[model samples]
Target: MNIYLTRHGQTEWNTQGRLQGWQNSPLTEKGRKDAKLLGERLSKIPLDIIYSSSSQRALDTAKIIKGNRNIETIIDDNLREINMGPWEGRILEEIEKENPVEYFNYWNAPHLYVPLKGGEYFEDVQKRSVAVIDKIIKEGKYKNVLVVTHGITLKNILNYYDNKAMENLWDTPFIQGTSLSKIEVRDEGIHVPFFGDTSHLE
Candidate 1:
């Protein structure tokens, strides 16, 4: 099994520094361009399934990659960005300025600070993400699968791949728009790697 996961393109809220948790925000022009470039980059790869978050941002990006292919895309709510709840559209700096204690931790130890007023816990997100990923790997049903998802979800998922404790989920780096990360199941075992290569967006 070989899995490829990508972050959705940018949106107005993303460029404007707004917390868009589960918000149905559309992608910006630049975001669309990035997705287009990503599509061109991935067109050559043989894909078994295309999966996306239920959110518009992710589906929109996934569509771009589908292009003329008849690939089917499944929308999964579990793949959505962290739910910000009360602070869905609020500015992070404002939240931090007001909550100095949270701000310090967010800066010094992001693994400790919560993203927004009512965001999902990092540990919980990591646990769920890991379970989902492990199940997919174990199934070995698809030779190749493409997933378009959100930032926080990717971070938590990567935490599992990187062998980082769930307690430091936020320590995983946030991948930018159209960035690609992959995992492979060799006959010997499984291998999760952080391959810093994004020639598709060139």
Candidate 2:
């Protein structure tokens, strides 16, 4: 199985540097265009199904990428962004000012970061996202699968495939909006061929 993973395209909150969390935001013009560009790039690839986060931003990107392909596009809550809870929709700067230590831990030391006001832990995000992926893999029905999700969620997913510790969660090759990553699953094992590739956007 060939699994294609991508973060949702840029949104208003993305440009504003807000904590979107589970909030809903429409895609910016560039977001839509980038999705279309990615669609064109994947046009020739035979994708059998698409799994997207329930978030509108991710669903929109998945639809745009689906284009005219007659495949089922499923939305899963497990694929949603980390539930930022009270921090949802808040500006990143404000969050940092209000909760400096936790904010710092969130970026630099993920394993030490603790969620505030009902927010999800990084481990929680990873478990749920990986559970969904394992379900897909167990189904064994699709040859090519496309997964559209949030930036943090995508990172958690990639981290699972790479077997990196939680401390190194925010490693190199940042997951850009609409950037593509590929993982091939075979009888041998899972192999990540490429990650955070934005050649389609260029």
Candidate 3:
């Protein structure tokens, strides 16, 4: 199966540096344009199915990409961004100021970081995200799919296929909004031909 993964476009919260986990936000003007551009790029490809997170930001992005196409987007909760719990809606800078230790742990040592009150565990995010894709693949259908999701969720799935440690989750470069990544899954294993490519927005 071939999966073309993309993070949802920029949102108001994104511009404000807010932690947008599980919280909904409207896409900014630039977000819409980027989505449109991505849509143009994907429109040239042969898409058999489309999947998007339940978040409005993701749904909107998917819709923009779908445009007038007859494709029906399958919305799934498993594709939703990580639940930030108490951290939702709060500016990331403020979180760093109020709880430097926890914030630092979340970035540098995700495995050791404690989940915020009512927040999701990193392990859970990775497991659920992987399970969703596995289920789709096991169904033996939907060979080519476009998955519109969030940065954290997309990162978790990418990391899983890369065989990277959860602790290094934030060590690499940030996953840009509206970026693209392609993964191919076969009986042998998973392979990432490219990851987090945002050249389309350039």
Candidate 4:
């Protein structure tokens, strides 16, 4: 199966450099335009199913990309972004200033990093996200699957497929908003054609 992964379009929080976490935010004008461009690009590909995060931002992006494709998106909570707990509505700068040590650890040494109060652990997120992917691949119903999800969730999957260490979580290049990544999964192993492709926006 070929999995096409993409992060949702930019939200107001994204532009403001806030931690979106599990919170909701509407897409900006450019976000919608980029999504439309992605839709136009994806329309040329052969997609059988779309699995989208339940988050509003991801759902909105999925709808835009699926545009008249006659494919019904399956919303899965497991695909939601990492829960930021108290950091959900806070700006990233504020979090960095307040929790300097932990924030530094999060981006640098993620294996030793801990989540905010009431937040989930990165390991937990990876487990659930991996479970979803495993189930989808096991089903073998769809040959081409598009997963519209958040950055961290998508990164977790990428890390899993690449067999990278937990400490290397943030080492991979960032997944840009509305960008596409194509990976092929076969009986042997996973193969990535590309990561963070935004030519459609260009």
Candidate 5:
């Protein structure tokens, strides 16, 4: 199976440097354009199905990518961004000023970070996101699958495929908005050809 993963296009919150979490903002004009460009790149690729986060940004991106394709698109709640709870829709700079240590841990030391009231742990996010991918793999019907999700959620998913420790979760190759990652699973084993690719946008 060939799994194509992409983060939702840039949104208003994205440009504002605010945390989106479960909260949402409409996609910026650039976001829509990027999605359209990606659709053009994938036009010739035969996609069996598309799984997208319930978030509007992700769903919109999935629909844009789907374009005129007849493939079925399914919304999966498990694909949603990590529940940021109180931090949702908050500016990152403000969060850092108020909760310096925790904010630092969130980015520099993920494993040591703890969620605020109603927020989610990185471990929980990974479990839920991986569960969805496993369910898709078990279905065994799709040869080419497209998954549109949030930044943190996609990071967790890619971390699982890379088998990296939680401490190294924020490694290099940042997951840019609408960047594409490809993974191939075969009877022999799993292989990641490339990740965080944005050539389509260029």
Candidate 6:
């Protein structure tokens, strides 16, 4: 079995640098355009199944790429982004630039960091992500699986593979729009990602 990870296109929050968390939002105009481009790119590639986060942006991108393929795109809530609580819909820079201490603390010490009101801890996101991956592997229903999810969720999956920490995990680069990352999944082992490949977008 193989896993291909892709993040959804840009959203208004993406432009505003807001923490989207559990908030529902759609893709922007350019994001939809990019989704079409992504669809064109994937149309030729054979995908047995497509799994996406229930969030509109992620599901929308999946639909665009799946297009007429009519591939079953499962809305896996487990693949959704981390719930940011009070930070949801708030600009990232506003929090980082103004709440420097809290931001820095969360960045450096996520294991010790507590979630804000209605927020989620890194551990919570991590556990759920791991569970979803396990379910996919156990199903063994398809040879190649495409996963469209959020930036943080993608990185968290990578962290699990690389045995890295939360802060270092975010440092990993994931470009916007039709990003494709490859990960090798052997018959009986863990997945190891090769990092995002934007060559298709290029």
Against the unseen true structure, what C-alpha lDDT does each candidate score?
0.77, 0.92, 0.89, 0.89, 0.91, 0.79
State in Å the error of residue 36, model 3.
0.5
Pairing residues by index, what is the TM-score of model 6?
Answer: 0.89
Expressed as tens digits, the lDDT of each residue in 1-202 for candidate 3 is 8999999999999999899899988999999999999888888888888989999999999999889888878999999999989999999989999889889888888898888789998888999898888887788687789999999899899888888999878765687888889989888988888888888889
Where is model 6 more than 4 Å wrong at Cα? none
Worst 10 residues of 3 by lDDT: 168-177
What would the per-residue lDDT of candidate 5 be over residues 77-128, giving only the tens digit for each residue? 9999999888989999999999898899999999999989999999999999
* Model 6: how far residue 32 lies from native, Å: 1.4
**Per-residue alpha-carbon lDDT of model 6 for 4-43, expressed as tens digits?**
8888988987887777889966789988877787778777
List TM-score per model, in order: 0.89, 0.98, 0.96, 0.97, 0.98, 0.89
Worst 10 residues of 5 by lDDT: 168-177
For model 5 the local lDDT of residue 99 reads 89
TM-score, cand. 2 vs. native: 0.98
In model 5, where do residues sit more than 4 Å from their true spots?
A: none
Candidate 2, residue 122: how far the Cα is off, in Å: 0.2
Worst 10 residues of 1 by lDDT: 189-198
Indicate which candidate wins on lDDT.
2
- State how far residue 15 of model 2 sits from its true place (Å): 0.7
lDDT of 1 by residue, 62-102 (tens): 99888999898877888888776666787878867777776
Weakest 10 consecutive residues of candidate 2 by summed lDDT: 168-177
